[model samples]
Target: MTAGSRHSVSVAGVVVDDQGRALLIQRRDNGHWEAPGGVLELDEDILTGLRREVEEETGLQVTPTALTGVYKNMPRGIVALVFRCRAEAGSLRESDESSAFRWVTAEEVAKLADEAFAIRVQDALAQHLTAPIRQHDGLRILG
Candidate 1:
């Protein structure tokens, strides 16, 4: 790593329901719809961070079932670990980070979220032998 250059790790969970829909949160900060997650704490493990972030933003307890994808926002130096999760418990509530929530199908996800964020949900829903690694520039996925 170069001096003064560091990468931050974030964890996001795409909570899938029995109806094959993924849960998305409308971020209060930007009003953009995306998965519920945030920067992982230094003291916490991956799953712990995933559960905490999802719960904090959506008020739903989630159990991560698969590691779906790893995405890097090249411009921001943020690497995000995305997971396919099942809602284990709790009711949905709005939080400071999220203003609203929606359970959307794959088609709706594409329309509601940015390309970079929508792909993470799509990857989680697909069946993959291994997690996919991707790069983005905050809004668009890169080649």
Candidate 2:
């Protein structure tokens, strides 16, 4: 959150269900659908950040099973840790940041995310077989 800093850390989830559909949220600010995630706190670890982000955004308790990738929001100069996770408990509820949520498959993620966030969704699907943690720079998906 500082000026001129080129790196910011965040954690996100690629939640899947029994049917293999992934969970996604419609961001309140831009109406773009994306995985549940948020910025990390000053003293928090990745796991804690992941759990808190998913819970706060979707009202779901997610325990990340695998890390899929690391993404850089180039425009904002922020870095994000992406994980393939599951909703261990809690029911889905729309929060201030998200207005809608749904369960979709790998194919459907493309529609929900469209072109802007295609890479993030692709990273999640690729992890379905082998979770590969990545670090890349690109246009901002959440911004």
Report, for every candidate in turn, its global Cα lDDT versus the true structure: 0.94, 0.78
29-109: candidate 1 lDDT, tens digit per residue: 999999999999999999999999999999999999999999999999999999999998999999999999999988899
List clashing residue pairs in candidate 1. none
Residue 106 of candidate 2: its Cα lDDT? Answer: 70
Which candidate achieves the best lDDT against the true structure?
1
Question: Which 10-residue span in candidate 1 carries the lowest summed lDDT?
Answer: 120-129
> In each prediction, how many residue pairs overlap at the backbone (N, C-alpha, C within less than 3 A)?
0, 1
Q: List TM-score per model, in order.
A: 0.96, 0.84
Backbone clash total, candidate 2: 1
Show the lowest summed lDDT stretch of 10 residues, model 2.
134-143
RMSD of each: 1.0, 3.5
